[model samples]
Target: MSLLQDLFTRPRRNEQMGSSNENRSVLVVGLGRFGTAAARTLGELGEDVLAVDKDPMIIARWAGKVPVMEADLSDPLAVEQINASNFDAALVAIGDSVEASILTTGNLLDAGIPDVWAKSISHQHTRILQRIGASHVFRPETDGGKRVGHLLASRYLDYIEIEGPYSVVKVLTPPAVCGQTIAEADVHGRYGVSVIGVKNPGEEFQYGSNDIVMRHNGEIIILGSQKQIDKFIES
Candidate 1:
């Protein structure tokens, strides 16, 4: 039997296998940096991941780490042989070639995979992928650049953008809020930002509460709209 056949027919590491509806069984195409990272992260999170790539060296390198197979996903036959429809989601992370990425994505969709996510390197690629029925198209380089720009331009130690204009930020507790309890500081009322968590030096993070005292040099996780967060950091 082929690798795809063996992977589909054999019992998974978890005895429950793909039978458990709570978890997802994902088919990851391509073995580039983004694909590898996604497969590893999904496996760590208890998701069933079957990663495929055309490179034999790449397959061997990730053998023990993630369930992987050697196959050129640009070919429709490869996708069909794997029973692509059985997967809850398919991520096409072929970054090098726009043609291969598009072909792989189309093949997955042709196989009836409902959620086919693809990685795109440019706006035109993104539009093409979307027009061809890709459920989602993500530009990792663009997103990462934005995140890095935000970090570099602000006092935030870490910044994460959520839906819309909201963001979550980790910042050093400023002098204005130091020596004051969360309730006394009135962070939410004064700055329109909510202190969701706090971490002191060399200590684990604790959920924010009314009684938690803020201290200089400590770190705080705040959530608010982008404008509110920028103002809070400036204050």
Candidate 2:
């Protein structure tokens, strides 16, 4: 019923969707809500999550919940202790301070983290994070923007633009598209988009296009480069 309940209600196996390997350790560089969620999710799925932050209060809050540490995330020494190159992945969720976000990400990349999933404030920051070796970066703020854009752009019941030039978008299946296979939709040929995944809000997700109608709040994600996404949006 509540947002927390909804998040926890998502299928257990689906929670940790990306990064197939769970045996490896994951480092969450910021202990903000986003970082906390990432850390807890990793920990829940049998992966080791190392959460670090500069705030003593935040660090103390998650003390036993997961392996948490208080450290100056911007300091290279703090990053050096962890074998970034060896860690399965890392997530940076520092809010507001663009420099701290950039610097901390640089430290992790420089430390040689195998993969980094940093959080950014905007499209510009996302690009910067990538240039610095962030394997991936997420923007909760921009995600909200995409949702709004989709709702406003079309008569589609739900909408979500895949971040960046990835023309792919994850949207609630517009009734206009219900009961139709992707090929029938001609999304690529017409909409200039490709399906990435489909998740019915309260049901399982179909990765890529396939047979099956996921439930309401079900998400249909289309993929394409930025230009392609723009074309779809404008259409």
Candidate 3:
């Protein structure tokens, strides 16, 4: 699968539950790392996407791969000219200039877009963006710290947050559970979690197997509430 597809792909349960929501168009301002990733994931999820950046080089890089435009997002007139009504949400991904990020976020809100997400470099910046009508503000550095903490605390190979208090976690089979089949393990009944899939060495995810005995250190993907996941890890 493509990078975007990989990023946006969800577990089967989530796919079924979320099927009712419409695929809304997204406008991502700035072609930086965060912006590009968001745009790619949005596109992979079948949403209409428009990516913008002021730099010509960045625009050239992602031109054919996705719909990209060049503009100084900080300029009110420049932002106002765009057909913002088409987009249901906007992401302010500008990393360097706080001024531009704030201005762009405000402009999007003023244009009648319902949701505006912004990236912030500091706590003060986050407060400023929130004051300017950004519906959501993220601090990448802070979130990165929390992610690393989760890895260390749970020893999970990978983790992704889902809606509410649920998470999907990938963990290697510990020595105690290595020889157990999914049925023998009784993961859901015992731990209040579901084993979504498993991955053996040199193999792709196999989601249909219940009798396959896990080998030592084989990886397993699971979906559960935070409390359930924590209990599973501790056991």
Each model's lDDT comes to: 0.87, 0.71, 0.80
The stretch of ten residues in a row with the least summed lDDT in candidate 2 is: 3-12
* True-structure RMSD, every candidate: 4.0, 8.8, 7.9
Candidate 1 has its poorest 10 consecutive residues by lDDT at: 11-20
Clashing pairs in 1: none
Q: Write the per-residue lDDT of candidate 1 for residues 1-235, one digit (tens) a residue.
A: 8545644655433444454456667899999999999999999998878999999999999998899989997898887777776777889999999999999999989987778899999999999999999998889999899999999988989988887889999999888888889999898999999999999777788899989988878999999998888777777
Candidates ranked by TM-score? 1, 2, 3
lDDT of 2 by residue, 1-235 (tens): 7422333233332244775653666778888888888889988888766788899998889998888778876888876654455565678889868999999999988876667788888779989998888888788877777678766865444454544545345556665566667666666787667777777666676776645553444667766765665565444
The most accurate candidate by TM-score is 1
Count of residue pairs whose backbone atoms collide, per candidate: 0, 13, 0
- Residue-wise lDDT of candidate 3 within 1-235, one digit each (tens)? 7433322232222234545575666789999888899889988988767898999999999988887888886877877656664467789999999888888898888877788899999899999998988989998878788778888887789888765888889988756667888888887888988888888777777883678777676888888998898787677
Candidate 1's displacement at residue 50, Å, is 1.5
Give me the runs in candidate 3 sitting further than 4 Å from their true place. Answer: 1-22, 157-232
How well does candidate 1 score on lDDT at residue 17? 45
The TM-score between candidate 1 and the true structure equals 0.77
Comparison by lDDT, 1 against 3, better one: 1
